[model samples]
Target: MPDAQLRPEPFIQQTAPAALEDLRARLRATRWPDTPEDAGWSLGTDLDYLRELVTYWAEDFDWPAQEARLARLPRFRVPLGGLGIHFVHARATAPTTPALPLVLSHGWPDSFWRYSKVVPLLTDPGAHGGDPADAFDVVVPDMPGYGYSDRPAGPPLDSVAVAGLWAELMTVLGYERFGAAGGDVGSHVSRYLGLDHPDRVVAVHRTDGGLPVFTGDPADLTQEERSWIDGAAAWGAVEGAYAAIHRTKPQTAAFGLTDSPAGLAAWIVEKLRSWSDSDGDIERSFTKDEILTNITLYWLTGTIGSSMRMYRANAAIPPAQHARRVEVPSGFSLFPGEPVLPPRAWLERTTNMVRLTEPARGGHFAAFEEPEAYAQELRDFFRPYRTGTAAD
Candidate 1:
């Protein structure tokens, strides 16, 4: 048990039957879009394939079994500024090595489930044929309004506030300092942790390698910068419609996504397939149960609205505010297939980059998509800083 000053665990049992029933009802009432021959994925999600996935999700998928599997992990909740934040605190059973306290933050559309596979790899590295000295006392939190955590009543769930709450959570768990890492929105939040609370975070790592907000300054860019800009522009042309919608009218978009399970699944699954290292097909890497479990967490907790609001809220902040430089030691594990991949020079301005590695595989969801390599990157990067840190 943690300190009594911290709020006791607030456990919410998942409703598998309710999730299945919701899927069935939504699929039965879905409105289909007409498509001509050879339309393919060029037209966003293929209607035929989506319908097939919806059918399996409603009829054949085993939600209860998945829920039972999740229940095996030790879960808890703690009060942070009047909101209950849910997290999984899994400790390694290893007796020979010291376990470093590390926090893993999940990005938009991905729940803490993203860390499930990587947790054992990190918390019990010896079991996976890795150095026991690299093991971590893993703490994976569901960002406010994302999982079992209830919605915040006051300010929106911005990156800085989320990082502050994480600091407090670690303190509550008795760690005076810790290491943090994330990808996508998680990457930004982890950067903020290093920037805003460097005294508490030993080191920080990100998979996206801090994306710069473009300002059309061609003269300021190097050859690599220009290439990255070109790639980002092309990606925005094909796949950034979701960003525009989320930034402009999250409330309007939330109504349909929050009300219909199918709508929510399509919106999220598109990102998972497009941004993950699954070779463009989600089913190739993750089971249908895995996909639905993530989406269901959003729908069941009524956080679709709040989650989208992060986009709108972030947009409201000034570009200069978002572009503030991070002074803490930061590492980047640039995955091969993320939306906006930044070159080292571009990222160096935004972060105090200490180490940068370009992985041959993985995408935005590196922890889940490439657990072994992702865990190894984390292990090697933080291993040197593990001693003399408050996290120990």
Candidate 2:
């Protein structure tokens, strides 16, 4: 049977009254922590702040309403190569001359909701004063085992395997060739899309500067590169506690994360604080409700364990994963606040290095944090290959 005719499994929105009850109970039963007079983020999440937030999460937050809002979005589970992948495909209402197809992938600790603000911007660019011809039919898939998607059932799903599934999904939707964009784990998948299926991928763009591969000469490093390295080293010292756990003992880490909502919240929230341009507090950029919504998705789906397992799978790959050079046309918008934004020389080693822009501001969640700038950067990058002229 043709792939398109192969019907996608409908995402049956599951609402467990018991799960909601459990969340309320957990919040009510939270063992309170005492705060130190001088302690701040240097000591991690503030206890007083936690007391207030957990109180709200239990007393004031409306899980049913938020779940209903999410359920309103179009969702599906398509069978691809013996795997059932779930995705949210929100189509643009306004017509585009050619109807450019674009796949926006999200990374770890983020669901399809990461691009919640971004989907409309790209699909309806005219609203943002962008060319109608540049409008896209956006496909935002939850990485397998991350959100509404299924867990890695039979075999371990790595980056390359997921890319193949993505190509299949796009093909099913009649997009012969399309543009791709992503960051974090998604950035790796986007790069693999360009490398593994260059014929179908017109151009690859990533928010993360580049992958962390030791390709450049350490001896010939500029002052900036040295600082970059120093910054990275410092982060590993202070903020990389999660990475170490995810890499070595993911199952152990998952136990605590999966059990306690507060534990999950603190673990993920710490990364958002350290990795984002939030200035100091997570609430400065993301509301407590917004933060918990993402966390709730993980907890409800029981994916905290499976998601961490991805790091272990990546680590098991041979160290020579970057020995091969990529030949696809690529663009990058490097955000300074991301975990490891790469230098131009480093990016050139992995991608064809077509276009590179250092954004004045933004973070790992670029599309959500700065939509206008991110949308403008995307329009500028993909303008060259758009099929229809503005006159058309």
Candidate 3:
């Protein structure tokens, strides 16, 4: 049992009626922007698609239904490391054997919503066509400044700081040792978890090995590794402007994104389309409601700024820290749709990589884009490390 001081309080999703109305009004009154004739997604978010999505957002999208769906998850808030952390904690369902404790961290442009689909599949595998013995007691936390979690009042918390908070959070949740898995920003957090708390983190799983940061001799890298590094640099040049803005001047970008629903949707929807396996059509992977739900969470929470500030905080992380290798057992799943895929040599150089897999589909948001496949990856990677029951 958790200590009284650390006991979690049940969280309910309830947005004021007026807030929802105001969002609709804002969406309906968006000032349209002009683009060159036949301009697709080459420049930025497709204007035609934004207009259509905003129109639906203003008139047809249903928030109450979405709220109800979110409410079905086991949500809670608990104070840890001077911040109120919101997370979903679901216990394994009728495990035929001991269940392992796993923590799923989310990344940028998303929150706990990123892992919503995979939660059930992991916690109740038997019901989802998997063995009950593979069930896991899953915990998905919204990093500070994202979702319902309170933003840091002072300097933005970087990945290492967030990892410490997660360590404490797991302790509060009665998990002394657990599996860690994440992608994007969450991947950074999990890497730190393995690096900083190897004794507690049974294993770490990540989608990518993080942006290649080799301070050693370039000759030390394999040919494949060098090629991957070059590809990542090239990819960053084209698709990394948003990150640059987030790192250098989040406040300037935040004003418009926080103020305009259409702008926020454009900012996030573009990534959802380009980063996922949708093949230029985002709707193929996520419904409008799904897209809106994620963006709306950012809008309602008014967290776009604080969330972006994390980039600035992370930028200050010393190169020495980046050069430090994670010794804990780790696994990588390179989803085909992800733009930058780290090679096996790069991963092995940086981590004690026990497994490396290239899944047939999915992208940056694999958990949300391919929940069953994502869940299966976790189950397979962590199976060997599941030494005891959830209670252990």
Q: How does each model score on lDDT? A: 0.80, 0.77, 0.92
Clashing pairs in 2: none
What TM-score does candidate 2 get on C-alpha atoms? 0.91
Best by TM-score: 3
Encode model 2's per-residue lDDT on 203-304: one tens digit a residue: 888998543555557786666666776777786787777777877898898888888888887778777777787887778767877777888888889998
Worst 10 residues of 2 by lDDT: 383-392
Using lDDT as the yardstick, the better of models 2 and 3 is: 3
Residue 211 miss distance in model 3 (angstroms): 1.0
Q: For each candidate, what TM-score against the reference?
A: 0.93, 0.91, 0.98
Ranking by TM-score: 3, 1, 2
lDDT tens digits by residue: candidate 1, 76-138: 988987888989988765725567788898888877888878988988888888988888888
Cα lDDT tens digits for candidate 3, 1-392 = 45668889999989999999999999888999899999989999999999999999999999989989998999999998788999999999998888899989999999999999999999999999988889999999999999999999999999999999888888888888899999999999999999999998999999977788888999988999999999999999999999999999999999999999999999999999999999999998999999999999999999999999999999999999999999999999999988788888888889999999999999999999999999999999999998843552
Model 1 clash count equals 0
